[model samples]
Structures are given as structure tokens and as C-alpha cells.
Target: MRGLASASVADQLIDVVSRIAVRDLATLRRYFPALSPDEIADKLVVGTARATEAVGAGVGTAAALPTPPAMPAELAAGVLGAATVECKLIAELHVVYGLRAPGNVRQRAALYLAEWTEGRA
Candidate 1:
């Protein structure tokens, strides 16, 4: 029963991560037409989901994550790198190009992924 409960929780978490990733990628693609859809989805969306999902969400928004517990180091690195890319895209879109919503989503995803990877929950 405990195992099943944990599995269910994990599943729910995955769902949330998926939703955020897909939405964020769609927004990102609008600004950067040069990037392939697959590339945006994999490196940005799924990466955010995996990294954030790993961290759990116990930590508040202001706190920095303390290294993910269950996640492999390589995966964590990939997520952070992706976050950097996302951040750059968002900065260009909002600061220079004046696209706001995408910028917001990307920023939020960055925070969520960092928190998730830190394993606060």
C-alpha cells in the first residue's frame, strides 16, 4: 500500500511537470523559430520537468535547492544547462523583443526546476 501510494504521488507529480513543460515549450517556440520543436521540447520542457520533479517542492520560492537527492548528477547538469538556455531566451524575448508571457513561464519553470532538483519535498 505504501509503495502504491508513493507511485501514485509520483505519477501526479509527473503530470504536473508535463503540463508545465509542454506549455512553456510552446511559448518558447513562438519566439525562437530557428530551434526545432523536438529540440525545444526535449532540452527545455522535459528537462525542466525531470529536474523539477526530482526536487519535490518542499522548499519555498526564495530558497536555492541543495542538490537533488534521487536524481543522477548528469541529469541535474543537463537541467541546469537547459534552464540557462531558457533564461537567455526569455531575457531576449522580454527585455529586447517585448514578449512577456513566455518570459514569465520560463522564469517560473526555472524556479520550480531548481526547487525540485534540490529535493525540498
Candidate 2:
């Protein structure tokens, strides 16, 4: 069922985001020592935009190729990819601002998901 697929996707995304490594302050500093916060944010925004677009394009391509029954799976994959990319962007922006959430990974991930949901609403 569609509902089942959606719930599975949400659970998997929560697990993935909670575990995925986002750049920390020190990591960002090492890689972008010369960049200002604004510059870092611009980079993050650009990268996120590209990744989101890629996910959209992937879904579009799959829709053009797959049978109707396969279309839903491709749709779900698109949703998952977009959410993961957006969550990573949110986490990176928090780092750029020197305000990465202070909690265990799961708690921090929940905050990012909440932010994502809020933005969608």
C-alpha cells in the first residue's frame, strides 16, 4: 500500500539521517579555512540545489521508463532522496552558523526533520 511505503520511507530516512556524517565545525574549518560564513552558506545552498535537482531529474527519467506499477517505487525513491538531501543541507547550515544542534544523533536528526516538515508546511 502507498501508506505502508511512505511510513517505511520515513523510518528509513530517520535512521539514515541520524547516522549520516555531516561536516562538523572543525571539518568545515579544515576544508574551508578561507571562507566566511556567508560564503559557506552559499556553497551549501548551491550544492543542495544541485542534489535536489538531480533527484527530481532521476524521478522524471524513471517515470518515463518504468511501467505504472513501478512508478510508485520511483516516486518513493525520489521522496527519500530529496528528504535526505534537504536534511543534510539543514545540518550543514546549522554548522555554518556555529549552532549545530547539541544532542545525540537521533535527537538532532529529529530537529532537522522537524525543520524540514515545517518548511514543507
Candidate 3:
């Protein structure tokens, strides 16, 4: 039962993360008025890599809080934090490229989650 409950919570968390819109098309375009979609995606890729590395690194990262936790706790935090960052990157890339995955928010989220897991934009 405990394991089941943990799984349920993790699923819910993933759903929420996937559904959340990190940015919209208009916002991305407005933010990068001078850059093409490909250029914007390039910048995002670099930023995401830096953020992911910060999350995985042990110290000096605000993204992974509760410093000095046990190994398991740190590991979990790093995983979740990096996932959140990657999701944001994927969402933003979709917006920049003017590509919306067809379906409801949940379905789109699932697609994005799959892309993230597969390690591609």
C-alpha cells in the first residue's frame, strides 16, 4: 500500500509538471524578437544543460534545495528538479517552433514526457 501511494503521488506530480505551460508561442516570440526559432532553441538547449547540471551537482544550486540531505533525498531531488527543467525546455521549444502536439493538455503532456524520457526535443 505504501508503495502504491508513492506511485500515485509521483504520477500526479508528473501530470502536473507535464501539463504546466512554461511559456506560450507569443511569449517566446516576444522574448526573442531578434532570433529565429532555431536560434531560440539553441539558446534554450544551452540554458537547459546548465540548469540540469546545476540540479545534478551537489552544492551551490538553488534549484535543488534542502542542502545536506541524505543521499537518497538528494538523489530524488536531483531527478525531479532536472525533470522539471527538461520539461520546461521541451515546452518552450515546441512554442518557439510553432508546433503544438494535438490533443488535450494531458495528452500533450504525455507526449512531452515521452520526448523528455527519450532525450530529444
- Report the number of the highest-lDDT candidate: 2
lDDT of 2: 0.87
Q: Give the TM-score of candidate 1.
A: 0.26
Q: Sort the predicted structures by lDDT, highest score first.
A: 2, 3, 1
Instruction: Report how far off residue 38 is in candidate 1 (Å).
Output: 7.7
lDDT of 3 by residue, 37-109 (tens): 8999998899989988877774335434655556555656666777778888987888787787778777777
Q: What number of backbone clashes does candidate 3 have, counting pairs of residues 3 or more apart or in separate chains?
A: 0
Report residue 19 deviation for candidate 2 (angstroms): 2.4
Candidate 1 residue spans exceeding 4 A from truth = 24-27, 36-121
How far is 24's C-alpha from truth in model 1 (Å)?
A: 8.5
RMSD of each: 12.5, 2.1, 4.0
What lDDT score is found at residue 32 in candidate 2? 72
- Model 3 lDDT-worst window of ten: 58-67
lDDT for 80 (candidate 2): 79
Off by over 4 Å in 2: 1-7
TM-score of 3: 0.73
Error of 3 at 73 (Å): 2.1
Using Cα atoms with residue i matched to residue i, what is each candidate's TM-score against the true structure? 0.26, 0.86, 0.73
Candidate 3 global lDDT: 0.75
Lowest-sum lDDT 10-residue window in model 1: 55-64
Runs of candidate 3 exceeding 4 Å displacement: 1-13, 58-69
Comparing candidate 2 with candidate 3, which one achieves the higher TM-score? Answer: 2
